[model samples]
Target: MTYIKERRRILVVEDDIDIADLVTIYLHNQNYITHVAYNLEEATKLLEQRRPDLILCDIMLPDGTGTDWIRALRKSADLPVIFLSSRQETEDIVQGLELGDDYITKPFDPDIMVARVKKRLRPAPSTSENMVATGENVWRDGWLDLHFDRFEVRVNGKEISLPAKELQLLFLMASRPGHVFSTDYLFERIWGLDNWSDVRTVMVHLHHLRRKIENTSSTHRYIITVRGIGYKFQAR
Candidate 1:
């Protein structure tokens, strides 16, 4: 008996026909199922119909910028998004990275693009093995709860969607509460050396993580800044 392996589905959201075709070709060559959407409206419709494993979105779309669309998408889904845009300015890249898992500039190598898709789609560990070797899978402290196995985070009894990287950062720190993880170390640990993004990516993700986990009304902070050092998770 033989079992068929399901090909990972990827949504290619780009307005340029040439670019979209080029990307679809490369993705297909890698045995991936690809769906092409020219604008935000089409992308939205496709999203509603098919759940792709990953998305390669162009920042500038016919209906709206991908950044704005993803900002809204993040409210419900923690799906992985990679921005494929020609806008190489610092501000544009920063804004894109703030809302996206990865940003790849245009005129990118098809090989590199396929590589990134593979990286993002790589399977994570099973629930039983998702936690740190010595850390508990579930952490519940009055106001916050982190379920590592389920990749779920609840604050004040409300569940919130945390992107992949943000969840990883939270779990890493939470696994060994009180241990200060330097920005450089955190960046290297989460993003890894293969990524070309700057170290500030760590700060960006950390800011977003804090916002989701910490209540705005309360003065309490689960992740404390060490002033000159890095950050640490304080359960107390």
Candidate 2:
């Protein structure tokens, strides 16, 4: 959000002088510590010097395009980014989506702009309130074990290697054992964007999760789909 930067850091990569100034002014009003770069060299230097929480980059830069920058950044990091460009064509939007979170056309409204920024800026709720840990790892029944401090999980007494998104999905579900989470709710809480991704993706991950951790013969599958509703992790 352009208005609240207390816990947020932002990188704005735009080659145009006027637009870059506009972006900095808006972000400054929001209280976010903002850095502006007009070229890939400056952006790279800023990246190596300061780690921003999110990046807003223009598609066309003096040194290179946003797509190239995205490809480079994603090689080592997972920072969310929103593309800013004058190109409004479908292909342009699609290409931008490949970059990250959201895309906005040149003539964007500040309110909508700030809203999208805020959505990505907010942090996810933790597994527990005590950010500081006591060192002992805990599990909820043999179904799921969380290393309260490490944010690691164990299922069926075996450690499961899950992708980033799947790991987030599992941790959120196990945070409240047996609590059924609707697709919309899960998407919002886990992905930070409501309906941004298809429900099928969630289903696929859950299916994979079950196959990996649950026995078909067991009456209680660790993650149970509610059919018409959504899914829940069986507490025990």
Winner by lDDT: 1
Candidate 1: which stretches are off by over 4 Å?
1-4, 122-236
TM-scores for every candidate against the unseen true structure: 0.52, 0.50
Q: Which tens-of-lDDT digit does each residue in 69-170 have in candidate 1? A: 999999999888999999999999999888988899989999999998888885643454333332334567668887756778888888988898999999
Candidate 1 residue-wise lDDT at 202? 88
Residues 109-144 of candidate 2: C-alpha lDDT, one tens digit per residue: 876777799888758335344232333434444455
